[model samples]
Target: MSLVRLSIKGISYSQTQNGAYALILNEVDGERKLPIVIGAFEAQSIAIALEKEIRPPRPLTHDLFKTFADRFDIVVKQVIIHKLVDGVFYSSMICERDKIEEIIDARTSDAIALALRFDAPIFTYKNILDKAGIYLNMSSEDKSDSEESDDILSTPETFGNTSSDEEIKNTYAKYTLAELNDLMDQAVQDEDYEKAAKIRDEITKRES
Candidate 1:
């Protein structure tokens, strides 16, 4: 099977699952997005990794892994979402040390979190993308921020029901963009990444 490169699109709160989030991966050369449902802790870790400006007072689990790897010279070269079974995606970390490479099994969420810290590439087989990828009705890049946020927050049927954009909009409707931004920054500083993500979403929803 041919490999398809993917990039992190963004993460969204899962409307149907309590304490869950949707980790969206975009096909680098295509319009389809692969949405993987992840637990809240994994989501928080991944979100923290993406927020370059937010540094936790202490290392998260994934951060500890990176520190340990660096201490021994084990480097994460890349991550591959190599398999999917019953809606669960399987991944492997391509690690290198002492001129030798090893493939280590990992959960998709953990692998991705590590990928961000290592600045490693992520890829999945074409078959997996074809089977589970979601295609938004409209082009997200060309849409206005309001439109793009709506397009992104609409969960794929396989993932579960999505909250209406208006519902999410109303949750933070009273906050101005500046206020929302401040709230997000405070949430991050407090290590409340889930809250930070929600606030961030609202900020995106209103940004022009």
Candidate 2:
């Protein structure tokens, strides 16, 4: 199957599932976005990587992996979202050392997080895209095209959270958007992605 490159678009709380976030991946050369429900930790890790301005005082797991890889002269070449099965994505990390390459199994979220740290491209197979990808309508003339398309399109399948131990409470609705924004920022700073997801979900619910 041919490979289609993808880029990180944004992260938002998954409305269908509590304590999960949608990691939106835009087709590199198309309008479709692949939204995969990932855990809060991966969501925050990906968000921090994308922000480029927020740095944790200590290393995150992904950060430590990056530093360790660099010290050993092992470099990540790219990440591939190789398979989608029963609403789950399987990814692999392509790493190189001493001119030899290796493919390592990884969670799609972890692969993406490390890909960002290493400036690696992300890809998925065309067949997989054909099966699971969601197309969103857009137009340069309509600024509200996004909101309109969201309403017009069929909702893509959403995966559920693995556990309820960290489920986000709905208390966020009592807070204003501004308050949620502050809370989200603080959550990101404190690496509290469950709180961040809850705040984000409330903000998105109000916006929609």
Model 1 regions more than 4 Å off: 139-208
- What does each candidate score in C-alpha RMSD? 12.1, 11.4
Q: Number of the top candidate by lDDT?
A: 1
Q: After superposition, how far is residue 153 of candidate 2 from its true place, in Å?
A: 24
TM-score, per-candidate, Cα-based: 0.70, 0.70
- Report, for every candidate in turn, its global Cα lDDT versus the true structure: 0.73, 0.71
Task: Give lDDT tens digits, candidate 1, residues 1-208.
Answer: 9999999887777554687777878899987667777777887888888888778999999999999999999999999999865445789999999999999998888999999999999999998887666544443554455235432222222222234557667878888888887776675444333455456545644662
lDDT of 2 by residue, 69-153 (tens): 9999999999998886544678999999999999999988899999999999999999877765654543565525443433201
Per-residue lDDT for 193 in model 2?
A: 37
Cα deviation in Å at residue 163, candidate 2? 10
Error of 1 at 29 (Å): 0.8
Candidate 1 residue pairs in backbone clash: none
TM-score of 1: 0.70
